[model samples]
Target chain A: MRTILILIKKEFLQVFRNPLLMSILIVAPMVQFMIFPFCADYEIKVLDIAFIDHDGSRITQDIIHSFDASDIFVSHGIIQNKKDAEKMIQHDKIDILVEFPNQFEEDLMNGEATRIAITANAINTTKAGIGVGYTQEIIGGYMQKFQEDNMFIASEEQIPARLNLSYIYWYNEQMNYKNLIVPGILVILVTLIGCYVTALNLVREKEIGTIEQVNVTPIRRWQFLIGKMIPFWILGMVEFIMGLFIMKLVFGITVQGSIPMLLGITAIYLLVMLGLGFFISSVSENQLQAMFIVLFLFIIFVLLSGLFTPTEGMPQWAHYTNYLNPMSFYMEVIKKVVLKGSAFVSVQTETIVLSVMAVIVNTGAILSYQEKSK
Target chain B: MAALTIQKVNKVYNKTVHALQDITFEIQEGELFGLVGPDGAGKSTLFNILTTLLLPDSGDIQILGMDLINDYKQVRQEIGYLPGTFSLYPDLSVKENLDFFAVMYKSDIEANMDLIRPIWRQIEPFSKRKAGKLSGGMKQKLALCCALIHRPKILFLDEPTTGVDPVSRKEFWEILQTIRTQGITVLVSTPYMDEATLCDRIALIQNGKILGIDTPEAIIEHFKGTLYTFKSANIFSLLEALKRCPLQCNYYPYGEHCHIAFYEDMETAMPQFLQFLEDNQQEHGDIEPIRPSIEDCFIEIVKMNRHE
Candidate 1:
C-alpha cells in the first residue's frame, strides 16, 4: 500500500508538471461543453420551400399565404412553372417544392378529390422528411378551414365525429434539445478524461522505458496499476463535477436524483473506463498504439450509448452490440437520474451491471499485466 | 558466496536469432564484474533476463540462491537495474525520481543515504530540475542515483557509460569503485574496451556467445600472436596493401597506427615483413611490438572462433 501511494504521488507530479496536458484536462472540456450541445442538435427549425401553383384561385392563394406565415417554412414565393421550382431545389436554394394540380378549384367544386404533389430534396433525409410532414399539415389545415366556411351546410350531417389528440412530453417538458444533449456531452467528457489520459500516460512510460525500471523493483503489478489508476480516476471525477457545474450553468440542468447516488454510479463507470485504459496500455508497446485502440473503442462507446439517437430505434444487431457497450448502461442510468428524477431503485439494474463490469475489467487488467515475459 | 549465477541460459527469438546461447557466468559478492561486448553482443538481453524482466527459454539462474524464474519477486527486491536506455521519468524532478524509487523498495532516503551519498551530492543541487532538461552526463548521473536509491544487493548497469563524456565516464567508474567498497555487487556492461580493465573480472562476449572470461590483464597476457604497431602516412591505403601480404597475420587500424598480429616466429617473419613493405613501396615508420589490450584479445578470440 505504501508502494502504491508512492507511485500515485509520482504520477500526480508528472501530470501536474505537464502544462499542456493540464490545460487539456481542465480547459478543453469546458470549451467543448460550451460548444457541442448547440451544434449537435437534431431538430430542424428552418427549411426553405418554393411553390408551383397551377390554379390561380382564391383557395390556392390563401394556402400559399398561410405557408409563408408559418414559422418553419421560408416561402421563396411562387415560381411560374414546375420546372423552375425543380431547378430551385436542385440548385440547393430550396428544400421542398409544393405543386398544386391544375383546376384544383374546379375539381373540388365538382366534388372530385385531387392531389397535391410534394417534391422534397432527399439529400438530407431527416430535414426532407420533416419538411414534407410540415407542408402536409399546413395544407390540410387550410383545406379544413376552406370546407368549414363554404361546405359546412352540405356536409354538416355527413361529417363524422373527429378524434382530438394531445401530446405531453414526459421527461423533457419543453422538448429542449439542449437538455438532452448536455448530459450526453457530460458523459463524453468524463469518458475522455478517464480513458484517454490514463491509457496514454501508462504507454508514455513504456515508450520512455520507465516501466522497465518499475518492473525491476519489488512493486507488485497490481500495486503499480492501482497507483496509476488512482490519480487519473481522481482527475476523471473532478472533470465529472466540472461538467455537472457546466450543465447547470449553461443549460440549467440539475440532477433530480440524489447527488451521492449519481456520484456513486459515476465512480463505478469510471472504474470500467480506467480499467479498459489500463488493459490497453499493458498490451500496447507505445502511446500511438494505445491511442488508436482507445479511439476505436471510444467511438463505438459514444455512438452506441444513445447519446445522439435513441437506442430503441437501432437495428436488432446494433441493440445486441449495445449490451457489450459500457457507455450504453451508464447513459441510461445518467439520463434517468438527471432528467427523470429517478431514485436509486429505478437505476438499480444499470448500477449493478456497471459494478459488475468494473470488477471484470479491472481484474482482467491486473491479470493481463505481465511483469515477466516468456 | 556467489551473488548471482547463470548456467546454460539460452534465448531464441521467433524460432530464430539466438540472442543468448549457453550463456554462463557468476559474480562474487562485492566484485565489480563487466560483460564486455559490442552493441548486439546480447549484453542487454542477459541483463534483462537477470533482472527478471525477461525469462530464458531454458536455464538455471540463482540470485542469492533464489530461483530467478520461480522466486522473481524476492529476486526483484534484491536487484537494481538501469537499462541501456535512460529509463527514469523525464517529466519528474530529480529528487522526485529518487524518492519515488526509494519508496518502491520500501526503503527511505535516510536509510540508504550512505550507500548513494557520493553520487547523490553531485546531483542534489539540480534536484528541482526535470530530468530531461539535464545534460547527457547529468542525466546518466541522475539515473545512477535513482538505481542506487533502494540499495539493492546487486546493481545491473547496462552500458551506463555508452554515451557519456570521457571525464564523466572516469568519474562514473570511480563511483563504482566506491560502491564496491560498500559490499554491493556491481554487474556493468560496456562496449568500451578501456572500461573493461576497471572490472575485477569481465566476460568477453560476441554473437550471443562468451569468447572468454577472466581478468583483463590475464586475457591480454593470453593473446596468441606477436602484436606490432607502426605509423603509416596513409593508414587506409596501407591496410589495403597489407591484405595481400603472404604472412599469416591479422591486421587492423588502431588509432593513427596500424596494428598487426603475426602468427609466425619474428626471427624470419620480421625481416620478410620489412622486405615486403619495401618491395611494395610502402612508406611507414618503425614497427614496435606492443602489449595487446582487451580489444586485441577480444578480436583474437573472435577470429580464432570463426576459423575453427
Candidate 2:
C-alpha cells in the first residue's frame, strides 16, 4: 500500500508538472461541454425554407403565416419560380421548398381541390422527415380553418382531430438535450484521456529503459498498478466535476440526482477505465503501440457505447454488443443519477455491472503485468 | 562469499530467439564484475535474469546464498539497478523521483541521506527541476542516486555510460569505484572494451555465449603469441600484404593499423618485417611489438573460439 501510494504520488507529479497537459485536462471538458451541447438536439428547429406561391391568394398567404408562426420553420423570401427554388435547395441555402399550383385558390373554390408540392433535402433523413411533417400539419390546419369560415363544412367537423403527444421524457423531464448528452460525453472524455494517459505511463518507462529500475525494486505489481492509476483516477474526478459545473452554471442544466451517488458511479467508471489502460500497457512493447491501442479502444467505446443514440433503439446486434461496452453502463448510470435523481438501489444493477467490470479488468491488468525486469 | 551465481541458465525469447544460452558464472561479494559484449550479445538478458525481471527457461540462480526465483522479493529489496536507457519519471522533479524510489523501498530520504549524500549534493541545487529538463549527465547522476538510495547489497548497471559524454563517463566510473570500496557488489555491463580494465574480473560474451572470463590483466597475459601494431600510409595495402605474407600469422585490421599475431619470436620477426616493409616500398610507417589490451585479447579469443 505504501509502494502504491508512492507510485500514485509520482504519477500526480508527472501530470501536474507538465503545464500543457494540465491545461488540456482542465480546459478540454469546459470547451467540449460548451460547444457540443449547441450542436446536439433531437427536435429540429429553425429550418430554412423557401416557398413559390402560384396561387398568391389570401388562403395561401394564411397557410404561409401558419408556417411562419410555428417555431420549426424560418421562411426565406418567396422564390419567383420552381427553378429558382430548386436552385436555392441545390445551393444548400434552403432545406425545404413549398410550391403551389397555378389558380389553386380558384380551383379550390370551384370544388376542384388544389395540391401543393413540398420538397426537402433528404441527406439528413431524420431532420428532413420532421421538417416536412411540421410544414404539412400547418398547411392542413389552414385549409381546415378556411373551409369552416366559408361554411363549406360544419364547424365541429372542420376542426381536425390532432394527436396530442404528452412527451414524458423519462429521465430528463424538461427534455434538455444537453442533460442527456453531458453525462455520456463526460464518460467518453474521461475514458479517452484517463485510459490513454495511464496506459502510456509504464510503456513510456519501458521505452526509455527506466522500467528496469522499477522492476528491480521491492514494489509489487499490484502496488505499482494502483500507484499509477490513483492519480489519473483523481484527475478523472476533477474533470467530472468541471464538466458538471459547466453544465450547471454555463448551460443552466440542473442535476436532479444525488451528488454522492453520481460521484460513486464516477469512481467505479474511472477504475474500469484505468484498469483497461493498465491492461493495454502490460501487453504493449512500447509507448507508440500502447497509445495506438488506447486510441482504437476509445473510438470503439465512444461510438458503440450508446452515447449518441439509444442502445435499445439500435439494431438488435448493436444493442446486444453494447452489453460488453463498459462505457455504455457508465453512461446509463450517470444519466440516471444526474437526470432521474436515482438512488443507489435504483441504479444497483448498473452499479454492480460496473463494479464487476472494474474487478475483472483490474485483475487482468495486474496479472498480466510481469513483475520481472524484462 | 558468492554475491550471485547462475548455473546453466538459458533464455529463449518468444520460444525462438535465443537471447541467453547455457550461461554459467558467479560474482564474489564486493567484487566489481563486468559483462563485456557488443549489442545483442546477451549482456542485458543475463542482467535481467539476475535482477529477477526475467525468468530463465532452465537454471539455478543463487544470489547472496538465497534461491533467485524463490527468494525474488528479498533479492529485489537488496539490488539497485540502472538500465541502459534513462527510465526515471521525466515529469517529476529530480527530488520527487528520488523520494518515490526511496518510499518504494520503505525507506525515507532523510534516513538514507548520508548514503546518497555524495552524489545527491552535486544535483541537489536542481532538485526542484523536472527530470526531463535535466542534462544527460545530471539525469545519469540522479538515476544513480535513486538506485543507491536504499543502500542495497548489490547494484546492477546495464550500459550506464553508453551515451554519456567522455568526462561524465569517467566521473561515473569514479563514483562506482567509491561505491565498490564501501563493500557493495557491483555488476556492470558495457560494450565499451576500454571499460573492461575497470572491472576486477570480466566475462567477455558474444552471441549469447561467454568467450572468456578472467581479470583483464590475466586475459591479456594469456594471449598466446607475439603481437605487433603495424601501420603505414596505405594501411589497407599493408593489411593485404601481411595477410598474404608467408609468416603463418593471424592478422586483422585494428583502427589505423593491422594487428598481427605471429607464432614466430619477436626478435627474429621484427627485423624481417622491417626489411619486408622497406622492400615493398611501404613508407612513413612503424611496427612495434606491444602488450595486448583487453580489446586485443577479446578479438583474439573470439577468433580462436570461432576456429575451434
DockQ of all candidate complexes: 0.91, 0.70
Candidate 2 lDDT, B1-308, residue by residue in tens: 89998899998988889988889998999999999999999998888888888888988999988898999999888888887778888878898889888887887888878777888999999999989899999999999999988988999999999988999999999899988988899999999999989999999999999988999999999998888886668876776666556665787878877788887877787678777777777773557778998888998889889999
- CA lDDT, candidate 1, residue A226: 88
RMSD versus native structure for model 1: 1.5
Clashing pairs in 2: A210-B87, A372-B53, A373-B53
Candidate 2 at B201: error in angstroms? Answer: 1.5
**Chain B TM-score against the true chain B, candidate 1:** 0.98
- Measured with C-alpha atoms, the lDDT of residue A345 in candidate 2 is 85
Winning model by DockQ: 1
Looking at candidate 2 chain A, the ten consecutive residues that score lowest on lDDT are A151-160
User: What TM-score number comes out for model 2?
Assistant: 0.93
Error of 2 at A294 (Å): 2.6
Model 1: per-residue Cα lDDT over B180-282, one tens digit each: 8988899999999999999999999988999899999899989999999999999888888898999999999999989999999999999999998998889
Which candidate number has the best lDDT?
Answer: 1
Any idea what lDDT model 1 has? 0.90
* The TM-score obtained by chain A of candidate 1 when compared with the true chain A: 0.96
